[model samples]
Target: MNCKEALPLIHEYLDGDLHGSEAKELKEHLIACPACRTLFKQLEQTEAMVRSLPPVRVPDTLTAQIMSGLPPMKKSRTWTDWIRKHPAVSVAVVFAAVMFGSYMSMWNDDKNLMVKGNDLQEVIIQGDTVIVPQGHTVNGDLVVQRGKLEVEGDVTGNVTVIDGSVNLASTAHISGQVTKVDEAIGWIWYKLGEIVNMIGS
Candidate 1:
């Protein structure tokens, strides 16, 4: 094995997780390569020293304080048990009530808001205005086609702007490059194409 391959396998060898054949190959390589042998010895010594350190003890007073601060444990009941005990009609009624309560909780949120699904990691702002909140993360592409983007969050992928402005907060992080287009038509077309591609996927 070369240095690159053997380097990665070193950890596996130390942990005794490598297959017998792979271990033997690594060992043979180590025997032939003095540099690798020296590195392996250093790594082994470091591991040994770390393992020899004693575990820390938690103070009795601190442990007692933590236990006192915790709430009392409640009896656990399975959802299956609860459902089985109720009649079909009663179960349906309960389910509807729960769903209604869940929707009602979000009723106060602005109706104009559009929060993308989990899979839609990429987002393109195509309107005249857009707002991205703090701590929100976009895992894929962020294309500002024709609108304003106020970002206080992170974008994991590329950010592109076309014929519009983007206002970035200090907290914003874009992992990929930012590109801009000059014309409105090109921006709209690109955004539409991206949306179509997302839907097809």
Candidate 2:
């Protein structure tokens, strides 16, 4: 199998959905072709990264409240309903809410510390260090601004560290992207966009 034929089947191979003969052929091609092998490894890494993000679990009551806060969606609604009707907007709202709630839960203490509980679903911030303790599980994304993120637990969502670093312990299991934005201007833009999205929503 050539690169052209092998590239498209990479996902199926990774998913274990390819037939035995097809899988064998792809494996052979990957072994013989350096470029294809690199692409295959990259794809594998991407899949692993996605599978490692923490899962976000919103409470039923919170869901009800958000739904109640939104204007009613009518079958005939158009332009004015764009914000509420847009799937991406809705997802962004939920993500922001979850992150906000997580950040709120960590209020009152400002010291650099680590997560202590199991089955958590909030964002935490420490002065310069944010640690997700061993055995702890976070169902929401984690954002650390001007600090570092140390993950030793299972996270089902994304981890974003602005102008800081990320350290994943041996036991760390993340199911989403781990992003680090080091540029000051980029961080400002990101924060601004976040604020705008929340306000728009």
Candidate 3:
């Protein structure tokens, strides 16, 4: 099969929906086409990276915050009646509360170092610091969270340091993009993008 046909199958395979002979056909196409193989690998990395992060949950305080921000209810106006009458306002309040809760969690959490990747035998760990020694090579994407990453060898794929810092030695070689994420709000955008990709796929 051609790339045009294999593209959807790749997404379907990642989604765990591809099966039978269709899966075989897609595999054969990926093996034959370098571009498709690269795309599949990228999609795999994206999926793995997103899945490695802990699930974001709205904090319990969100309910109290939303309720406290609302105007005092009158004896004649019930909560259900108020919600029915102002559906849009209610939705907005809930959405705002959720966003605020997520932001709060993002700011308060992630104080410890976290690393996610595959085939990281070359990566060194010491307290909150991660190091890739000289002459070593990492085969896939490397992600470090709330820590420091020092690279002295080679990384074949992307390197993303979130809420952390990275130091690359003169001998360090990275084949893919390197990203340093310092902002707290970046998590929200990443989650949104992941959701969009999942829905579109």
In TM-score terms, which candidate is top?
3
The candidate, 1 or 3, that scores higher on lDDT is 3
Off by over 4 Å in 3: 1-111, 194-201
Q: For candidate 3, lDDT tens digit of each residue in 121-198? A: 466766677888899898777888888999999999888888899999999999998988788788667567649967
Please give the distance, in angstroms, between residue 66's alpha carbon in candidate 1 and its true position after superposition: 59
Each model's lDDT comes to 0.52, 0.59, 0.66
Candidate 1: clashing residue pairs, number: 0
The alpha-carbon RMSD values of the candidates against the true structure, listed in the order shown, are 20.5, 14.7, 15.4
Least lDDT summed over 10 consecutive residues: which range in candidate 3?
A: 101-110
User: In model 1, what lDDT does residue 105 have?
Assistant: 8
TM-score of every prediction relative to native: 0.31, 0.38, 0.43
Answer with 1 or 2, whichever has the higher lDDT. Answer: 2
TM-score ranking, best first: 3, 2, 1
- Give per-residue CA lDDT, model 1, range 1-201, as digits (tens): 898788767767866788889999999999999977866775564345234322222233433443365442222322222222222322233345345531110000112222222212223333345555567776665655445667777777776666666777898787887666667677677669779977998
Top lDDT hit:
3
Any runs in candidate 2 off by more than 4 Å, and if so which? 1-127, 192-201
